[model samples]
Target: MNALSHKIIFFLFKLKLLQPSESTINFWLQSEDTDKLEYAVTQGNYKTRKLAAEALEQLAKPFSIPALLKCINDKVQNVSIACLNALERISTKDELIKTIVKKRFKWVNEIREKREKFEANKGKKYNIYRWERASKKSFDMVKERLKRPIR
Candidate 1:
């Protein structure tokens, strides 16, 4: 599709005027033009990048994991947060652990620890209050960092 058409579709999708059918997502997942989706994830406007990450999460194909990983470094905090949230949902435990070991992403260790704890507690009900508290603390720290003046 042409650039204008792509923009219109993205706009409609963002506005909720166009709900992507499974086939549409599948098409993007399999098409050679997958680069377009990757480009949007990495280089599109903030809103577009957010939407693309969301779509990748919903599609949840393994191939999209790398793109999602890269998006974690987006300059925009919200875009990075969105990508992180999507990664949590779509990445396997092994992949998350691997990422934790390989990348210095914020909260990667916390995410790995929570995943390990969740696995250990499987088949038994467990309160995640501690995890929630830690996550909130991390988010607050990030917010504070963002507010500070850069050297």
Candidate 2:
């Protein structure tokens, strides 16, 4: 979009005349503007913020670290997870976030291992209960981390 159109949208958005839309997230993703993507991370709705976080992760811009760090505390579980994943990708120097990412990957790998061993090997009954419990446990652990700001 032209600069004038963007300015108009920002004006309307600031006046509370327009709700944040997924289209704006798409715009930021396509434009690859780190500042605008950061704004979306800070200001967009839950779903919009989630998409913006994923987009920033894909872009992997170093400057977006501060914005992603702030977004990791979003009230929405998915948004917080998305921000955490983005930080995992963008902040290589942060050992703590990297460790968290490793833990998350371990949980995922364990789930896949269980599925393969039970379902693929013996063709036995799928243990949906166990999978659900493990999934929830992992989710709650991540959610607990979301309750506080990441350093």
**Evaluated with lDDT, which candidate comes out highest?**
2
Instruction: Report the C-alpha lDDT of model 2 over 29-128, residue by residue, as the tens digit.
Output: 7778778778778887787788889989999988888898787667776787788889888889978768866776566568669977877778556656
* Residue lDDT tens for model 1, 72-107: 878876677778777777666666545653564546
* Pairs with steric clashes in candidate 1: none
TM-score of 2: 0.58
lDDT of candidates 1 onward, in order: 0.67, 0.77
Give each model's clash number: 0, 0
* Candidate 2 ranges with C-alpha deviation above 4 Å: 1-3, 100-151
Candidate 1 C-alpha RMSD relative to the actual structure = 18.5
Q: TM-score: which candidate is best?
A: 2
lDDT of 1: 0.67
Please, what is the TM-score per model?
A: 0.45, 0.58
